[model samples]
Target: MAEQKQTVSTDDGLILAPADEKQNAVASELEGSGISSPAEYEDLPDPDIGKTDAERAALDKALLWKIDLWLIPWLSLLYLLSFLDRTNIGNAKVANLEKSIGMVGRDYNNALTIFFISYAGAEPLTNILLKHWSPRYFFTGIIILWGIIMTLMGTIENQAGLLACRWFLGLAEAGLFPGVNYYLSCWYRRQELGFRAALFFSAAAMAGSFGGLLAAAISKMDGIGGYEGWRWIFILEGLATVFVGCFCYWMVFDFPDTARFLTADEKLRAMRRLRADNQTRATEEKISRRYVFQAVKDWKTWVYAVQYMGVLCPLYSFSLFLPTILVGMGYKGNRAQLMSVPPYAAAAAMTIFIGWFADRTKWRGYSNMAVSLMGCVGFAMLLGSSTPGVQYVGTFLGAMGIYPCVPNTLTWASNNVEGSLKRGVMVGIVVGWGNMNGVVSSNIYMPQDKPRYLTGHGIVFAYMFTCLFGGTMVMHFMLKRENRLRKSGQRDHWIEGKNEQEIRDLGDVRPDFIYTT
Candidate 1:
């Protein structure tokens, strides 16, 4: 059958063309309308311009709720397990896993370091592969693999066995974080991302709080079936993760276009709504090497990575050491585990609230800076106070400040990038770099630095300050400068006269692509 030709309007005028000629027609129309470059096309009317406000609002609410119901819970659960399995070693350490395994000196730290090294190293490659595979299969496969590795952790008879399990565990878990971020971006608009990202990330905070309680209860099962409580912690939690993965495999939605829950009209509405946001369109475009190269060349990826690292190093240390910190503050056994719960609980609540606020205000960079300052104050309190009560308060402040920034930074990177491949690569790079600091975190606090851990607190404090400065500079200088250039009629030649596919391939460097600050 012959292709049907159709008439479409552009800024210049209406033109008759085949459906497949849309890009060329639009480009010609744009060129004829004094829009010589893509930068000048920023003011083009939204693709959803025909929709009434009432219609849009109703559709948006319905679509968002549907997505929230179908997507967030499953993703959050996955992240929760990822965080729990990774950080459960911390809980186990306090439960005497070290004595059982004969881990001495910096051996525990080395185990943590090795996990992150593999975790960070595998991220980029995993993300690229995720782009090629079905999200449901890819995600479920990794979760299952990691769950198996996590279960094997309980069976480790020596440090070498533990180290090998952690290494493979990291490799299994590497794809989830960045892959989910990129996946979410494909479905939701930038403004809607913060809370969703938070919704996903607050699971980590929940894991911290819940892991403590679970570990405490499981610790009571020591010497059961010839397994210690710490061993039971790994075995039980790992099994639970595997169970969830198996159950939720069918619930995972690939993208808006391929979502099973949505009706045909709803699917079209979802895609149109995203396109109207003037961001990258969600499509299963083949992984392009050019997009990967573009993402690598984009300085924002590295900048965001560096900024994220400052937060991650401290956050990782905190997650891995909070129980120990509580123990040092005079809580003992199950009491210390229970005591570690409140801070994470508080952080979880604050993470959701801040995510909502950031989305509402559309000021991600400012929100990040504010949270970093809060973290600085929290660390200051820890440094200044010797009293346990005051230090416990510091933990609350630290948790609140640190946890929110994770989602914020993740969303911020997703918001600024365009194109699936570029976004995927960028998310991978940023998250990979951020997690790389887990190495630094692992070694930052030694066993000798117990109780106060002054050196650890000080290092985190300094990094918080660096995060503040970096956030400020990026918002005021980099993003602002790009916005100004585009607003002032300056054009990025890279996108000039490009067809739709070419422009999409250009990612955020496209002249019309405005960076959200």
Candidate 2:
């Protein structure tokens, strides 16, 4: 007699019976739903259902391309503008913004610190609203409001006005970075996300490069329209951001299932692919307090947040002070602005390459450690060398190292987490916590410590090394051990259910789910 084959059934009514038994079991399940037999089911031309592996892969590739075309450019543009607006004050400071606005003492640093306060505080609420409202409306509305605030920043005549504008700008912009991150997680699988995130985040590096060039060009616009060049920087960039926001209102996609561009079959295939990857779908699950609490309690969320904090301190300081640093190295005003561009351009290229490599290798943690170590070396060079040329090279090394690690850190947190609600909450917590370094960074490099900011460089160097060690230990020791336990048949207690949502609600703690380190 032949050995008996085991059978399994899924909550979705899919039957995993032997070839001969499969048809009958499937037919029996469908009979209750009015499909009388497997023959009739097979006769239906439902391209979305029952696809072969080759066909599924082909459709997934095509759908991903369409998603990339529709999503990445708009999001990248929006992020570029956000970063430019946030850091343009640095460019403006070089062009006499402080003198023009009568900012004195630590007012500039205070202005920078105030932005992060509102930004971090509003992050969780903004993420909740992003889910409640559609991404199209929520994201566009955010951009428009921040653009308005940024434009008003050009009109400020005093420190108080500038502070108010910066605070409101932070509030308006709080949702965008984390919102886009969570949105990407909904569309792409873990392996695909690193590159997609890099494409999205490279915009920030591009913004640093482009903002320099734009500031250089606009510096000539001084006294044009009775406005200073710094004023023109804010006014023009803000107005352009508003225009793009209005245009993207009609163009930006929401979740995959609700995206207007995808066909019925494509939408079905997209959701199916995502479900197959991690046994979860990006459906509009109820916003449960339990999900938020679960994400907060996850040790990986806090560890990754701490690692991100190390990256952000140097990144924020670099973006805000690169022009000033270059000027201090004996470059003239316009020369300093132009000089700031190269490091950021190099960073953009490195970020894209590293992102692609991380995805291909599926080693997010190791990739992050490598890049972060490069950042450590870069900072060490800055601290040890007083030569202007050597310090300039340090900036390039720092840029390439730090910027590439950002996308990996983000994807690491997003990849390991499960469920839309849990992932959303986790991303918001991680990003908001990580941004606390913005406050630390703003205060680290003061006017007294200018010309090299040696103290600042030392602090950032130590932090990068901390990030490397923390990430390696967690990945190699904690996550690896957990994977082993799961593979060895040690399972966490979980509730069994006939409903898919119930199982998905278990989130990352579900026994079958293995974290991507």
Candidate 3:
């Protein structure tokens, strides 16, 4: 006799059957709704009800492409601007920002540290409120507000003024990174998210390169319009950001359920595909204390948070201090800015490729570990040699190592977590805490440590190694073990007598919800 496949029926209209069985179940449910034939519902025919596998696959591909075109490019642009504005302070520093403003003795680092402190505090609250506020309006308002603040930064005369601007800039800019992560999770499935998220995140690397080139060009404008080159960096970039933010009000979209770009049938198909991808977990749009508690109590949340911390420390330090490092390596002012471009360009390419590869292999944790080793080697090269050429090469390797790990880890966290509110909260927790490492990054590469910054390189290397052998490794094995227990039916007892709502309330802890390794 053939083995039987176990199935569970639910009162919430979600059928917990295997993939093939679930398709048939969806069709049956559609037919039962009294609109079996297309003629009966001509205005809004069911797209998936009677489709063949090939037809469905084509539709899926087309829908995904449409979504990519609509969401990725604009989001990437926004994040690029966000990153450019955030880190151009590095470029300004090399252009004598501290000297012009009378900043001395760790004031620069304090400015950097203050931004991240405000950033970490505001991140979680912004994520929780994102769904409640319209993404389009919310994104537009924050972008414009930050742009105004950054533009005002150009006029500041002292460390006090710069610190105040940096604080509010952090508050205004905190929403975009985590907000985009949560936003993309709602559109893409577990398997498809890695590449899409990477595509969006690769903008940061691109921003690093672009900011270098742009700064090199804009620096020539020193004393033009009665402002120094450093001030123009903030003023011009800030104005452009405001322009983009204004345009975003017209271009940005809300969730799929209300997306005006998709037709009614396409929207239905999008929801259905995500439903299947999620193993029938209904997308929870509303927030409640229950989901918040579930997110905070989950062990995986803290593990991913630690993993993210390991990545962000080096990543932030490199972006914030790359130009200065290049200058330290014997490059002149404009040459230092120009040299910052190539490493970021290389990192951007590797980041996109690894994101695609991670999705294909479904080996997110391993991918993170691998790239982290590359970063280790890069930092080691920096510490081992004093030659400018070798150190330049090390910058390339370091960029490649740290940049790609970000999207992979983010996708891993988003993939395993179920439901909107829980995932949002988890992302907030992970990203918020991870950003706190910027404090460590800011302080490590002090002025006195310049010529070689031994402490900075060693500390970054240690953090990258931790990403490889510490949090990421442990989380990978622990998740694998959990999957094994679930496969052995060890978790079935929790759902044995529970109703649909009870089991649903279990969230990712439910037996049917298998984790992605």
lDDT of each: 0.82, 0.81, 0.84
lDDT of 1 at 310: 80
What digit string (tens of lDDT, one per residue) describes model 3 on residues 1-517? 2122334333221224444565555664433331112232343345676766567667878998999999999999999999999999999998889999999999999999999999988888777778888788889999999999999999999999999999999999999999999889888878789999999999999999999999988888999989999999999999999999989988998888789999887887777656655523233456678778888899999999999999999999999999988888999899999999999999999999999998887888888888888998999999999999999999999999999988889899998888888898899989999899988988999899988888899999998897544888999899889876665567677877788668766767876676767
Model 1 lDDT per residue over 1-517, tens place: 3235454544212233456866765664333221223342463343344666566667668878989999999899899999999999999998998999898999999999999999999988777887677788899899989999999889999999999999999999999999998889888887889999998999999999999999999999999999999999999999998898887678887788778899877776676556545455556467668777888898888888878888899899899989888887888889989998999999999999989998887778888888888888888898888899999999999988899998898888888876767888888988998899999989988889888989989988887788544755665478878766654446445555678777655656655566667
- Rank list by lDDT: 3, 1, 2
In model 3, the runs with Cα more than 4 Å from the true position are 1-45, 279-284
lDDT score, candidate 1, position 298: 87
Cα TM-score per model: 0.89, 0.89, 0.92
Worst 10 residues of 1 by lDDT: 31-40
User: Counting only residues 3 or more apart in sequence or on different chains, how many pairs clash (N, Cα, C under 3 Å) in candidate 1?
Assistant: 0
Off by over 4 Å in 1: 1-53, 468-472, 492-505
Candidate 2 lDDT over 1-517, as tens digits, reads 2223223343221222344665565554333221212342342234545655566557767888998999999899999999999999999999999999888889999999999999988886667788889799999899999999999888888999999999999899999999999999999877788899999999999999999999999988999989999999999999999988888789887888888999987886676556545535556577768878988898888888888888888899899988888877878788899999999999999999988998887778888888888888888888888899999999999998889888888887888887887888988988898787889888888889878888888888877888644655566468878865654445433534435556546667755566665
Instruction: Report per-prediction Cα RMSD to one decimal.
Output: 7.0, 5.8, 4.7
TM-score: which is higher, 1 or 3?
Answer: 3
Clashes of each: 0, 0, 0
TM-score of 1: 0.89
Clashes of 3: 0
